[model samples]
Target: MKQRAITGLFFIIVMIGSNLLGSYVFSVFYLLLSLFCLLEFYKLVKQGGMQPERFTGALAGVTLFFFFAANCYFPAYKYIILLPILLSFIPIGELYKKSEAPFTNIGFTYLGLLMAVVPFMFFHAMAFTRGDGVFNFHVPLGFLIMLWSNDTGAYLVGSKFGRNKLFERHSPKKSWEGFIGGILICAFAAYILSNFYTEYNRFDWIIMSLIISNFGTMGDLVESMFKRSLNVKDSGGILPGHGGLLDRFDGLLMAAPIVYAYLYLISN
Candidate 1:
């Protein structure tokens, strides 16, 4: 319990530091983290008996994210059009490799890109999403704040009053009691955040909070399903008590893109 709390606090500090530092730090931090997560996904896929071209796959995912970052930060950079060319390495590299399921490998490689890399890229999208095309820390910061609040509330509430299983198959610890508690707490946090980060106003913040809370639970379950298939307890040992980067960001994977789309549609 102590280890989990310490690790969770350090995680929050790093995220806060990245957001407070500015766009460059935030971009570099998330990009590198995305690459590490891509590598971990490939490792798990390999453990499932399909051989992924790890180097090419990871490189492709990283390059795709970098391409997106450059495009968002500097619009003219979009003309570079190098992402497609870079992604070609996946299948071309597979030509020399020996795998019984070449297409399966390619599919999972792209799945890693879609599931993990793309979501992180969407997080970047949130920063520069305003019509003015300037970075805003509050938007992304609000997301992290809400997500953490949901997790904390769920753990505390579920541990105390949980009686019904949320999804006993994929995650035995989860409960409907926990999920409802998390959503309510997140909505309350959204109200507080509205007082400070008022660009979205109080109503919008609560709506976004509800979206994140519900989908974030789904994302956690999705990752749990992945690990259950692989018969592993944790994604990786990178974070001492928190598991791996993948484990940590599972909720973000499910929440960020949907929230980004919602934010875009409403704002624009």
Candidate 2:
């Protein structure tokens, strides 16, 4: 218990440091993290008897990361067009494969790539937006805080007050009590942080909090589904007492994209 607590504190410190460094450096870090996660995801899929082209999938993942990053740095060209073009190849590549589970492998790999990279890219883009230089740190930092709040709240509340299962089949340990606790804590954090954002209205912060809370839970469930399907406990053993990069950022993966879309819709 002591070891886990200390490890968790260290993880939080590193994440805070990364966010303080702003978007460009953080994007580079995220790209590398996504690459590692893609490898782990592919390895798990392969272990499950699926024959995905690991190298091809990895290359595609890297290419997709750059496409999104390009869009971030060069938003004027609307380089976002590259995303669909790269994504379209998933099915096309499956057609050339002689493997029995080509479609499933292709679909899973593509979905995993989107799940891993798109949100990180969106967060980066949000950070680099014009006239929002200082606010850049807040965008990613907000996400990290909300996600960590959900995770910590859920575990602490669920352990003490849990009764009704949230998802009995997929995640037996998750409970309604924990879910509500996480959402409430996240919403409160969002409320407190709203004072820091002079540009956004109260409604925006409230809505953002709601989105993060719900989608963050969905992200956790998504990863849980993957692990359940593969009959594995954790994604990887890279982070001490924290599982892996994927495990740490699962909630952020889902939350970031939703937050980006929210900002994009409101700003445009």
Candidate 3:
């Protein structure tokens, strides 16, 4: 418990600090995060008795992230062409290796990009969604706060009041009571965030919280399902108590894209 608390506090500090530092720091920080998570995902895929193109896939994921980051920061330059060219190496490299399940390997390689890289891309894009080409940290910071609130709220509330299971098949510990707790707490966090970050109205923040809580739970369940399928408990041991990058950001994995869409729609 001590270790978990320390690690959680450190995670919060680093995340909040990166957002407060400005766009370059935020982009560079999350780009490295995206790489780490992608590699960790490929590691898990390898543990499942299949060989994915780890290096090539990692390169592709990095390229994909850079492609987006470049667009966000330097829209005048065309880094778009580099992504496809780098991605082409995946299948080409597979042909030389001659693995028994080449297509399966290819599928998982791409799956890592979709599951790990794309979500971060959406998240990174959110930092620069304003029409004036300015990078505001309000959306991202509010997201982290609400997300952490939901996770913390669910854990505290569900541990005591939770009775009925939410999804016993994938995650037995999760409960509907916890789910409601998460929603309420997330909404409250959003309400609090609105007072500080007035870029979005209070109602919009509430809506964003709803999107985060519901889809964030789904994200947790999805990661649980994924780990169960692999017969593994945690994604990795990088964090002392948080399991892995995937475990820590599972909520963001699913929630980021949806929240991004919501912010985009309302902003436009």
Candidate number achieving the greatest TM-score relative to the actual structure: 3
TM-score of 1: 0.96
Clashes of 3: 0
For model 2, the local distance difference test gives 0.77
Q: What's the CA error at residue 246 for candidate 2, in Å?
A: 1.9
lDDT of 3 by residue, 1-268 (tens): 9999999889899999999998899999999999999999999999998899999998899888887887776673565877788888988988898688999999999999998999998888788777567899999988999999999889988999999999999999999999999999999999999999999899999999999999999999999999999999999999998899999999987999999998888788
Q: Rank the candidates by TM-score, best first.
A: 3, 1, 2
Residue 56, candidate 3: alpha-carbon lDDT:
92
What candidate 1 gets wrong by more than 4 Å, as runs, is: none
Per-residue lDDT of candidate 2, residues 1-268 (tens digit): 7877888889888878877876666777777877888888887777778876666667778877777665565543466566577667767777888888777887777766776666666766666554333336776677677777777788899999999999888889999999999888877887877888656777787788788878888888988998889888888888778787778778867778878888888877
Could you say which candidate leads in lDDT? 3
Model 3 pairs whose backbones collide? none
Q: Per-candidate TM vs. native?
A: 0.96, 0.87, 0.97
Better of 1 and 3 by lDDT: 3
RMSD of each: 1.4, 2.7, 1.1
Evaluated against the true structure, the overall lDDT of model 1 is 0.88
Candidate 3 at 54: error in angstroms?
A: 0.9
